[model samples]
Target: MKRLLNAIRDQFELTHNEAKSALLFFVIILVNLLLYYSYSAYTVNEQSEILIEDYGKTEIPESEERKSNWVDYGSSYKKSAKKVERFSFDPNVATNEQFERLGFPKYLAKTIINYRSKGGKFKYKEDLLKIYSMKPELYADIENLVSLPSKLDKKTPDFDEHRVIAEEKPAFAPKKTFTISKFDINTADTTQLMQIKGIGKVFASRIIKYRDILGGFHSIDQVGETYGLDPTVLPELKKYAVLNTKVKKIRINDLENFRHPYLRYNQVKVIVAYRKQHGNFRNTEDLKQIKILDEATISKIEPYLEF
Candidate 1:
């Protein structure tokens, strides 16, 4: 140690007092570091004990404790469950309480009551199957206990001897025939369309609404697309209806071009993007440039395109 100090003194020419002062300063710093480490350890241990004591003494309110108990026990508690007792029932006349006792859900019981109150009748046991909420398994369980009339009274024919004789006399006479006037489907309003034999207000309105959506019908066959129009009535409608082929044309560049029933949003996006990239479409055939547009779709939408 002394030789090392001599080498240090020779290298830097330090006085003995200066070397001793530097050594003393380093020792003081080392002691301070050790003291700080010990103090920190003691503080951490004291804080941990206080935290554990506070946690052990924490108290929940009574209401919160009760709520927690309910959350844990409510679903499994037998007293909270609905008691269903099977019994013979007539859905048409059974009271709501009776229906409930017979195992019908509360909403279903109310529905059945409302249906009866509105003059709806369960003419047969099978009619209960029409309840929107009645599951097949539940129906199967109660099917045997439901009592309903074998046949409704309205379905029974009323016998009249005098009317029967008059009908038999008229059976030999000729049947009358009527001619229906043909009308233009494009120009015919709901009132005029309802003049057709089987066309009612609902059917006429549907036909007009669909025609407006299409801009106008190009063919009488397109009338078949009207919602709720029966297939059997299509022939009758075709015989009396004529298409003028005058339809409102949609501009290809219009922002609302996607409103057309035949053009989907994606197809419209592709068409608009292509028009911007390659310039406006020159003709209907230019639509084929979009790979997703099949020949069938192009043909269907061609009549409605202006450019």
Candidate 2:
């Protein structure tokens, strides 16, 4: 050891005290490096232990955590939720409290109460199915308990058989025969026309008003042309009513001709222009020359026009 120290001192060109001081300084640096390495390893191990402990506290398996959360949620829900009760009820007349007691939800109970308050009636037990919010399972459960009538009962007369027979027996059974008398359409008054089976007061008045407008009826079919007259009653009217051919006529030159129902404004204008350009209308056929008048119209107005 002395020889090695002497060789080092000679190589470095140092005396004993200077070499000793340099050796001491080298030993101090080596001790500091060892101490630094030891501190670094200890610090890394301690950090790893701290990280593992923190992860163990904060992180959990997803499935196990979810299960725990669901248990707590269910307990909370049970405490907060309303308890449903089941009972018989008539939906049409049942109060809101009764509806809820019969296991109906709050919203559904309010809807039913509002419906009943608005004059809505559930005529039959099956009508409860009309509620859109009604659940099939819920309806099925209480369907039998709904005390509503399913259908209207047939009405029966409460007449005593012997009394009805005694009262209904007439002096004699009348013979059944049918005969209808014909009448003139032109001259028949309202009361006389109403005697017909189908002609009521309104129809009789309409017939008279139309006849007056036309001056008189040229054919029994003209009665069918009366406004508001039922077409179904036309055949009956034709069977009982006859028109007199002797009817009043309006001259084509007269301004009163415009009042004719068959002559519209355009047709009246055409007729007046044509008559001014030409002479008076010689016959009903002369009306066909007017472009506004069609063949059907000429035929319809022919009976009412007397040259």
Candidate 3:
């Protein structure tokens, strides 16, 4: 033990007294660790034995044991028929009361009504599935009961409404008018964007897609930058478009790859390499140090980069 302590003192560049103290401390810690593990193992085994003995002594009542094994298999094991009743009704024209009478929940019935109030129509039986919170089991129960065609005619935009019996068909109510005079371009969804006269589903989706890629629009002119958007639609878009949200900026020091629409692959590589060599960029002026990044390129991408 003396020889070992002397060797440790030399190896660790420590005095003999310091080495002895360290050795003593290490021995004490090792003893404590061993004792802790032994105590834990003994306590766990004792608890396990106590649990097993207690469980063996305890007895479950026969009623509860039988109930535990009972699994409800659809409507067979149920005490009564499902509260939901089946009925023939038009989802588009069905009143809230009619939906409730068919055993639909109040919230679900309200959602169906709200969907139609927003110009949503159930053209086919499958379209009912599009309604929010509509369950497959509920739809399956009423599959043959809806007063609409199972499938739409491929060639026609509108399906024939007379497919169901004349008396069974529900009278069509006038659709509620929905209009948006103005909305923030940064926050408007595809639904709101499509309300514009010239902006259809494609343009609406493209604008949103580009906006996401750009980290939200900073200017109204940015909306025009969206690919395939018609120039004629710019007038109408500018009239209603507002940009209230701040643009999401990228951290120049932390980013492994630049994902902005304005920055090219080569530019991103150069910027990352420069940051590695020179450290974090302080501002756009430091970015201008890269010869490849001209004034125009730096100016365009400057707003998106954070120091």
Candidate 4:
């Protein structure tokens, strides 16, 4: 012990008294820690014994209320084994009920049905793995059961020709015709817009939303600016939708907060700050004074602003 203290003193460049004091302090801490842990272990063991004794003696009475309230977590966690029917069936033609009979969960079966309803096809057995919820283990088990073609003949030289001919033949079938009528773009609601040939629920909703953001459409061409508007549908849309209503304009001086499809956030901030620093904009000429507002930008928004 004396040699260990001498070594520590020499190694740390400490005096005899400092090294002795440190050693004593360390010993005291070690003793305290051991005592603390020993007491904790004894306390824990005593509590455990008490719990065990109480559990052996305790009697829980059976009652309907208790039974109803009590939950068996062990049983809840255990999955009920589904009866899997191993049978060959075409994935593209299989119904939801048939998928369920083949051990697929109801939700996954519905997913397959929805994919088919949206014109998705399974041309190969490997395509079954394309489903997000399809487990590799589950697919491995049923891989032989998929009745799709082994592989697509992608290398066929005349495949494109045959496909084009098949598509062109469908053109000869008499197409169901519907009459399209003209309606005011600004005043027309979603139901009225959906009545047009090309516009559906999604596009109709987007048109109304964009119009609301812009305070209303100023011209028929502005409807074409809607996000994801199909170019082919524009002629049909223009044929039925007319911009006859006057657009609501934003007052330059009284504008507190503005939202426009054309104006970005920072550009708007600069415009508002310019108004505060200089004066309210008189016309498009005053807006051109701000370097950020270029000629084309000012021209685009000129119709929507009022002095």
Candidate 5:
């Protein structure tokens, strides 16, 4: 090939050494061009075949996809942290949508938003407990979801037509003024005691402590044994205080769906309690053995219950 190139160079009127050197350069250039053409053809073929191979590889379904930072396997990484820091809500300015976003029940969200629209602000944190149709315990579960305005957002909320409807709703019963003696000392739970006109957690706890220390409260005055038990509270306390020695201890089992006061016909909580205290029931009739439960309550709940 070199000799042929040398002769061709000579025929073109080039010197032997010059023709040889020129032929060598031409050979190098030709080899480079061949390589470039090969690479270009390979690249084109690769691109065309990419679709046939599913864009170079098969895609994973979203469920099987590698998740982004916020998502993993299924849920958001931030959401997985059970103890969520609650969002702040300006009650006066909060919308029903905002309340729902905070996980308030639909009725509660509407009531809270409507309450604020009527020139109302939660003067105290506990004032939130007074919303109609809201249970004290349910309110507590959602309480952490409440977020007040920052110092910059501290302006009071204006009252609107929504407020009128909320005001009309009587969330609380007429505060039954009662002495501790009027409430069956044994029967009152924290909830029933709180319903008494003037009672709060501190006073209620004191009454229970007093009952425990004395083995049982024989009289309403014995409640005075509690530290910080205001002597003047007695005038109000006497109305609610009922001294009954026959106290029943109701144990809470699975907390998911027990102790709901509205569920007066709950056979499940009673059955669960019975099973815990006595043992697996020998028969269905044994359900009536619970003093607080009756045949009607059992009949209403029998379908959902088990041993």
Candidate 6:
């Protein structure tokens, strides 16, 4: 302490009180340093801003697209369904293999069937987004694989309201005889259903045996129940179908009895679903299994029962 005091008083030429002032200045500098460090630490402890947007509407630059190169990094590249000549993607009709071909996980394929069975249809691209916990990236992957068209009601579209109208032949037309030469709706195979105009391979097959449990359609409107037939096509289907077409429901005891080879899958599914619910097909309503069922279908299948 004496050495410091002598150095301060001699070398610096400071008064006794001046040295004390110098000491006070050093202490203030130390306190300022500490306060600075503490304030910096506190301020740094809370520093952030939240962000909440992924890839929605960002302008992904045309120049970036132009500069993109074709690098072969994947084992194979998948094409969009729209790019392909023919790709099957009937959610109700796609097999597990077909589902995988469309790039959906196999585990979720059955869930998709359940979705369809519950009256869901892949009507729009957005519908796939509604799947449970479906990933956005996955939707981006398969967005192109989905195909949907507007639909009309089979009841209104395919019903032949003009059947009687056409029957009212004039005196000259009274001599004009009409002969039937088309496949019967009640017994036609998938191939046979195709003879009808506007019915494609997919729609034809679905119409014949979609709910094979119900036998044939009791009403022409039942045609609308076929896959891909939404309310939009009702006017079209109505032109070609007759509401009084002979059709029947499966017997309660013989839920397993569809003799048509084309209807095998539908028949078996109906039996299984029937047994699952009521153990027997006492009524057409027993067919709520295999997929979705509705009052409209039940009414259609109710007319031609033997049991």
Error of 3 at 43 (Å): 99
lDDT assessment of candidate 5: 0.59
Query: What TM-score goes with each of the models?
Result: 0.41, 0.40, 0.42, 0.42, 0.22, 0.25
- What are the per-residue Cα lDDT tens digits for candidate 3 across 1-307? 9998867665553556778998999999999999999999999999999999878676666797789976443332122234556778999899998886776666678899999998989978999898866767767767788998876545654436545444766778899896667899989999889877667777788899998999988888878887656566688888888878888999989988867788888889999999999999988999889998899988878777778
Poorest lDDT segment (10 consecutive residues) of candidate 2: 71-80
Model 6 whole-model lDDT (C-alpha atoms): 0.56
| Residue 217 accuracy (lDDT) in model 3 | 83
Q: Which candidate should be chosen as best, given lDDT against the real structure?
A: 3
| Cα lDDT of model 5 by residue, 141-246, tens digit | 5565556423334465535412544456657878886443455865577776666644567667766765664445556775666665446667666776676664
TM-score of 6: 0.25
In candidate 4, position 85 carries an lDDT of 80
Mind giving the per-residue lDDT tens digits that candidate 4 earns over 129-211? 88767666666767789876555545654463355544444446678787767889999999988876556777789889999
- Cα lDDT tens digits for candidate 6, 1-307: 6677646544444556676777678789999999999998876664421122333455555665556853332212233232323363655567767775665554466678788889887765666777774557656665556564323323444233234334654565456554435444666666655545456666666676664645566656667766554344556555554544455544546544444322355655665556766665555545554354455544444465555
* lDDT winner, 1 or 6: 1
Which wins on TM-score, candidate 2 or candidate 3?
Answer: 3
The global C-alpha lDDT for each of the candidates, from Candidate 1 onward, is 0.74, 0.72, 0.80, 0.79, 0.59, 0.56
Clashes of 1: 0
Candidate 4 matches the true fold with a TM-score of 0.42
- Write candidate 2's Cα lDDT for 164-189 as tens digits: 65466567768867566777888998
Where in model 1 is the C-alpha error above 4 Å?
A: 1-179, 254-256
Model 3 earns a TM-score of 0.42
> Where does candidate 4 stray beyond 4 Å?
1-177
Model 3 CA lDDT for position 34: 100
Instruction: Go through the candidates in order and give the clash count of each.
Output: 0, 0, 0, 0, 24, 15
Off by over 4 Å in 2: 1-180, 254-257
